[model samples]
Target: MTMTNTAPAPTVWATLQANDAPALIDFLVNTFGFIKTAAYADGDQVAHAQLDWPEGGGIMLGSYKPDQEWSRRPGTAGMYVVTADPDALYAKVRAAGADIFRPITDQDYGNREFGVRDPEGNLWSFGHYRGEPHP
Candidate 1:
């Protein structure tokens, strides 16, 4: 069965923990076109950060803290981002020297997509799929 939502705005966000939160934020903003909305940090460790995708939605991330109750392991996140122009974004990502694990191609599901790894080792897939319509 397929599930759908009719919410007016996005209420869910993808989150991750990075070994170097600041650098990761920079890479995401510069390489993937994510907008750096906010970041709270203490010295070299980031407490929180928000990066918004221009098309829609965003993500929250912070430094990897093993002792914290909500601690998450770094380099283990995999996110799929929806874009309107995967081909253009793919070219830009490649120009930035990002590690491309999958070349851009047309999928049988009717989406054009590609995959890349960030400097922090997080996997990111960009595509033109917007998902099914809300019911």
Candidate 2:
């Protein structure tokens, strides 16, 4: 017996906490080209925000409030994003003053990749690697 799936693969989403959400949003949009999808505020402070990538998927974020019951340390996330042009993205990220952790280079696994840190210090990596079973 054989089975066939018909639904599109679910997209993976990540969350980030920021010390200054508005500033972070500006950095993401201007430097990384992420589009602001939604942003909620509480008394002039961003309560929550959603930024979408043009290619697909996105990341959620919020300003950290010490009084909040649920909050994580800002700048403690490491994320990998797949892109069609790592070299071009790397150039943009570099020109935007992103702190590069690793220069763009080819991997033995057949990926061209680069790593950098966002303004808030979240580790971000971009690559052409699609991982396994993504053909």
Candidate 3:
């Protein structure tokens, strides 16, 4: 018998709201390497957007709307993204002049990681930790 290994597609997504959704999308794409998969908009307001990380998984975001029932405060979300190359990413982010709150460093758990604040004030942590295998 032969078996094929397959990684599952991401189902759960990290989501946030941005004051300037379009600019935030550009920053994430140019600075963090996120691919802009889709973005829905209404004039100056973005209704929704999907940005996929090159490695795996992705994030969803939209324009800030405090009056909406599902409204989320802009700049209040924090996310952790897994990456294979922290040093290279750190260099790119630094060159882009992003606000890095935590410098790239090796963790006691054997992962290399760094943290930054986006233009919208959201916190993002990137690391090499892939998490423990599922039981």
Using lDDT, give the best candidate's number.
3
TM-score of 2: 0.86
RMSD of 3: 3.0
Backbone clashes for every candidate come to: 0, 0, 0
Error of 1 at 65 (Å): 0.5
How many backbone overlaps does candidate 1 show? 0
Local accuracy by lDDT, each model: 0.93, 0.86, 0.94
lDDT, candidate 2, equals 0.86
lDDT of 3 by residue, 17-125 (tens): 8899999999999999999999999976999999999898999999998998988999988899999999999999999999999999999999999999999999999
Error of 2 at 94 (Å): 1.3
Candidate 2 stretches greater than 4 Å from native = 1-11
lDDT of 3: 0.94
Q: How would you encode candidate 2's per-residue C-alpha lDDT over 1-135 as one tens digit per residue? A: 999666454376788888889999999899888899999988558888999876667898899877777787898999888889998999999998889999999998899999988888899889988679945
Once fitted onto the true fold, the runs of candidate 1 whose alpha carbons sit more than 4 angstroms away are 1-7
Each candidate structure's TM-score, on Cα atoms with residue i matched to residue i, is: 0.92, 0.86, 0.93
| TM-score: the better of candidates 2 and 3 | 3
